[model samples]
Target: MTRCRYCNRPLRSARSIALGYGPTCRARALAEARAKVIAQHKPTTIERAQELIEDGGIVPLRGNRVWRVVSTDGSTTHKTAGQVHAWTAGLRGRHTCYHRVAAQLVALAA
Candidate 1:
């Protein structure tokens, strides 16, 4: 017997058999679409960067790097920020930052 694509139950209705998903699944899909439409759009990390300054704070681009910032100065500049964060997280030391300005930025963000 042909099964419902959604619930995997044996399809009883002629329409449910033709279309892959059952009536319940179709309703669920519609509700999900509507919820997405109604939900507020959240900005990504990069996009939210601008708002950081508007609230009267030390902005990332303008603010100095944390005293604890990990060096990427000469050689490591080729690496991405994520790579730098990962590298710093691995090191065992005091004052070593997970990012160029992470220590300072965290204080600023909070």
Candidate 2:
């Protein structure tokens, strides 16, 4: 017999040993830990951009020779003719977005 380090409950069966907590206590603790991890690493601007582009949820609109990519979240990136030309030339087979560009730059560094 052993007591759970977290809940101080008597652990007798294999199931209890595996959980190391009473069922209710184990579930609550797991939920709390998951929330903490999520809160710690909330999505960044670049991350949100990558997600939008990867999902094909951004639409590119052209006006007066300028290009703009708009996301459903109302985020928009305006590009000059030169900037758009350079981006298309450099993108090759990879995806491109003003938001995702920063994220991809970070990912490459990593």
Candidate 3:
């Protein structure tokens, strides 16, 4: 039996176009997509942080420690390293290295 990607519910039919996602999952996905489109039109804190990181205004800290702050274009500072560390530590796979965290940060910033 194929399982839903978002909710892990069993697929009721093989002909279902939304193969792995259940009805609730499909609705949630649609809602999230719509919200993302709306969000793109407005500059939120996340968007600003992404711009700062992409513009090289933020640099990942050295060593295995997981906390760093970056200066924004207006001399404001944004901190994301601690959040990243906490997220990575909560993962079930192999322990995440500092390099992995750095890469993830860069990706998130982008």
Worst 10 residues of 3 by lDDT: 96-105
Using TM-score as the measure, what is the rank order of every candidate, best first?
Answer: 2, 3, 1
> lDDT tens digits, residues 18-61, model 2?
86777677767667754543344435645664565566543344
At residue 104, what lDDT does model 3 achieve?
42
Per-residue accuracy of model 1 over 3-86 as CA lDDT, tens digit each = 876678888788878876588986675566544422432234223323332433222332343222224342332121211333
lDDT of each: 0.42, 0.49, 0.49
* Residue 105 accuracy (lDDT) in model 3: 43
| Model 3 vs truth, CA RMSD | 11.2
- Write the number of the candidate with greater TM-score, choosing between 1 and 3: 3
Q: What is the TM-score of each candidate against the true structure?
A: 0.29, 0.37, 0.33
By lDDT rank, best first, the candidates go: 2, 3, 1
Clashes of each: 0, 0, 1
Q: How accurate is candidate 1 locally (lDDT)?
A: 0.42
Model 3: per-residue Cα lDDT over 7-102, one tens digit each: 777788764435467767876765775455435443354465456545665455554233344433355544445224333343443443332333
